[model samples]
Target: MATSVDKMSTDTQAESIYFLNAGAAQAEQDRLNRQHRLFDDMMQNDLLPPHVASALSALKTPPKILEVATGTAVWLTEVAKTLPLDAEFVGLDYDTTKFPSSLPPNITLRQADMFKPFSGDLLGKFDVVNVRLIIFALKEGQGTDLLLTSVEPPSQAWFRFQDINWRFAKKVGRDMNLPLSMVAYIKEAGCVDCDDKAYPGNSQLYTRGREDWISRTNVHVKALAEQSLRGITSLGGVEGMTTQKEVDELLACFDKEFEDRIVHYLFVRAWGRKPEAD
Candidate 1:
């Protein structure tokens, strides 16, 4: 269950000024929610391992969880169902428009920028801080750097692996310039027991409705690619590296590659725990 925090309505002007497209925000949120659902289903409906949940459940007091850049707060709400009744969950996002109208009493939504430093009260308050799929919004190393300095002791941080292969991106005609490894950043942040695991997807994972899932995923990917293309010229400020016509051609190529099952995507999750004071 989740609870809504008392906060002002989303600032439409700020959102429009800050985001690439305000309208696309909702679409992206829907796509991300679907992706989270797919991951959970693929992992047998367990968001984390039995041991992780057990460790959190054993805390003397209710665990306080924070999710940075929590688009739609889908992950927090889903995981909250498995935790103790008193466990508190907070989903922080810069934009509040996508937050649900109602939430479980234990869950709260906060509108905050993840790029900025956390307030003193927020430092080290959470048992777990979760982040996922904000790579497109972040520059290389920016997200990981913020997490490293912001979280407090006894807190665990988790980040989903994003493929930042600039070479492969250049071949596809999209220049994202992402970092080499987010997991490495976590280790640099002084978190103990940092670990990551990758999950490769194939045709068999879809099982009952493989074609349908693929069709939907393809649509989502196409939309994301389109958005990324638009940002290429705008956000990257790379003048004349590729024309709009070239981007269209590349997108077409991507669609065909995906349909032909020649393109594969990998999903990875990394986690680390902060050591208690000396």
Candidate 2:
């Protein structure tokens, strides 16, 4: 009786790798989160995919769904509402407190550490496991920054990001791991027939006048570097890698890079199935 978190759990090594290497990268990930929010727009525009909607509509017993790090359920609530009864959903995170209290009845949110193995008691089993935005935990040598097809021009934002994210990760002595691996991790935990998707994000559409993703994220990256380095040095945790002035320098460097072009956005989605008899 393994739980969903058992396989996809984020241990201290993983978290440490992310914070250590990514402690310098801020704007990129957060900005990406702000965009392509399908769930956020679901209630308003019925933006969910036709197949997902259809699948949900047919559910007699709500399909059991698991969402990892469901930030605000900006998507979960809509997913739950769109689905038929018996479509049970469980969202987990260390910060489950961030979940909105207005959650639908079919949806259950819990606060738990996902880094460990699963338990049959708490997590029944899942039909579809939805994982988003857990890339920060991958240490390195994962995949390229991200792979996505887009309609945008030759800004090559995605390629540049691949460099930056890996660059920073290497700096912290971590190998970049792709998010898709977590899906395999799920399968090894007894999930059957895992599914994964990497798609283009809605950033280009929303970023028309906002500048290409690289430029946009560059500013945020620089800011994040400055903030994190300053904080680290002030309290000084890992080592001397981060310091007030060092962070400031990193900010300026990123600012200059942003002024140039280095980093972009892409869409990615992955899912897997869990057996009921487990």
Q: Write the per-residue lDDT of candidate 2 for residues 1-278, one digit (tens) a residue.
A: 24544443334334444342233234433533444343233223443444555665676655777777665655666677666666788887654334565767788877655555555655656655666655654444332234432223333333343444445555555534455465666666776666655544344435443455544444544444444444334433243343456555555554554454433344444544455663
Question: Which candidate ranks first by lDDT, i.e. highest?
Answer: 1
Among all windows of ten consecutive residues in candidate 1, which has the lowest summed lDDT?
152-161
lDDT of 1 by residue, 112-206 (tens): 77766776777879988889766545543353211222111121111110121232233334314322376777888999888876554343335
Model 1: CA > 4 A from native: 1-22, 141-180, 203-206, 230-262
lDDT of each: 0.60, 0.50
Please give each candidate's TM-score.
Answer: 0.70, 0.58
Error of 1 at 125 (Å): 1.5
Task: Report how far residue 277 has shifted in candidate 2, in Å.
Answer: 3.8
In every candidate, how many clashes are there? 6, 20
Q: How many Å off is the CA of 174 in candidate 2?
A: 4.8
Cα error, candidate 1, residue 171 (Å): 16
